[model samples]
Target: MKRYTDADTYDNKIPSVVTIGTFDGVHIGHKKIIEQLVEAAMQNNLESVILTFFPHPRMVLQKDTNIKLINTIDERIQILEKTGLDNLVIHPFTKAFSRLSAGEYVEKMLVEKLNVRHVIIGYDHRFGRNRNSNIIDLASYGIQNDFTVEEISKQDIDNVAVSSTKIREALLDGDITKANVYLGYNFMLTGKIVRGKELGRTLEYPTANLHIKENYKLIPKKGVYIVKSEIENKTCYGMMNIGNNPTVNGTHQTIETHFFDASFNLYDRKIQIEMLKRIRDEKKFDSVEDLKMAMQQDENFSREYINSIL
Candidate 1:
């Protein structure tokens, strides 16, 4: 798929069948919209286009508020690319772009610039200044501009509509099993291995510490989890600890993973860790020996659980 940053880079003459939204998490609902876009584009022999923005609009509008993103811009692009779309447009949103009226935006971006034959959007989707655009407004504009506006209704999983907020709540509560059910896959973190204090080695269970670079990515709550770690593209069973090591009086929070039946110099290497299940809450042990015993049990449980499942 071609990634176009703006109209100047989008030199294709192919009529675009476009879908526009934040597409946060790329959850089931977003999947439905993309699937419909793909089928519609294929049926009409049009190019599939996705229009998203860098630095989520809300983050720009609400500066002081804490805005945690479900996926980074790079992550969102990766997900959209896998959906078989022909063009992915990441418009650089600015103050002037945000100030455009709804009608002006539709006329310029949808009708003239993109040459959109058919535009697909979610039922609750909105655009332009003060968030005034709605499905009816889009349809009216579409009628005037000689184009089509399609609204995709929400998709539900187990009577609950799949949403980014719900997934965030699940992760905040350390309910990754339920979160994965909503996300349609395991939650993963990819980062480079960094040097950490030599604490785990003292306990006989050496760990590779990860330094995540994606600022918007959310980390799960404090706990240990059964995980699958890919080091140099080789997957291995592992146990991950996500918390401050209270047992050793550590002050900094850490994400440490120990791979089962694998050993390598992981320093400076990139790794991707897929969280499978939360094993137990992080706690302080009575002594170093007590912490060592607990670590043994955690390792054994993680190995057996991952072996049975995989």
Candidate 2:
């Protein structure tokens, strides 16, 4: 898919069928909308365009610094690329852009900049300064601007809303299964391998410590989880822990993964780990031996779970 970062320079020669949203997780409901968009574009012989914003409008406008996102901008783009979109536009969401009136947005961004022939949007979609425009206003604008507006069904919109909420809640609750069901894919954590205290090696379970750079990307609940990753193009299953190691008297939270039967050094290598299921809550053990025993049990259970799925 062609990706354009500058909205002002987005001069598509072909007329486009567009959909605009944050599309945060690109969950199942969002996938449905994207499917409809692609179908509409094919039927009308127009380019399918997705206009999304970076820095999430809420983060910039409302100064919601504590807000966590399911995917980083790059991760969102990677996920959207699989949906067969013709063009993807990542526009900067600045305060000045947010101040544009509804009419100006439709005329300048949609009609002139994107050459939009049609728009597929949710029934409750709102835009303009302080969200002054609704779907009805969009339709009115479309009528005046010579473009068509397709309102996605209310049921679909509600489903999308519910799915997004449930997915976020499930992930925060460590319900990976429920989150994946709504997302239509495993939740992933991308990070680089970093050095730890080498404590896992002492337990005979050497681990790769993950260091994620995106502060906005949501980390799952503190617990142990069954995860999978591709190392050197080979799929490997592992058990990951997200917590402060109470047994070891560690104070800082860490993401440590111990791949079964793998011994290769991964320091400084970037990797993506897909969470498949939650194993158990992290616990403080009485002694090093007790923690080692618990780790063995966790590994055994993880192997069984992975094997059963395969």
Point to the candidate with the largest TM-score: 2
Q: Sum up the clashes in candidate 2.
A: 0
Model 1 segments more than 4 A misplaced: 154-161
Residue pairs clashing, model 2: none
- Model 2 lDDT per residue over 230-310, tens place: 998889999999999999899999999999878778999999999999999999999999999999999999999999999
Candidate 1 local lDDT, 215-288, one digit each (tens) = 67788889999888666668888889999999888898889998888888999998778899998999999999
Worst 10-residue lDDT window for candidate 2 reads 3-12
TM-score of 2: 0.98
In model 2, state the lDDT of residue 104. Answer: 92
Error of 2 at 89 (Å): 0.6
lDDT of 2 at 303: 94
Q: Report residue 279 deviation for candidate 1 (angstroms).
A: 0.1
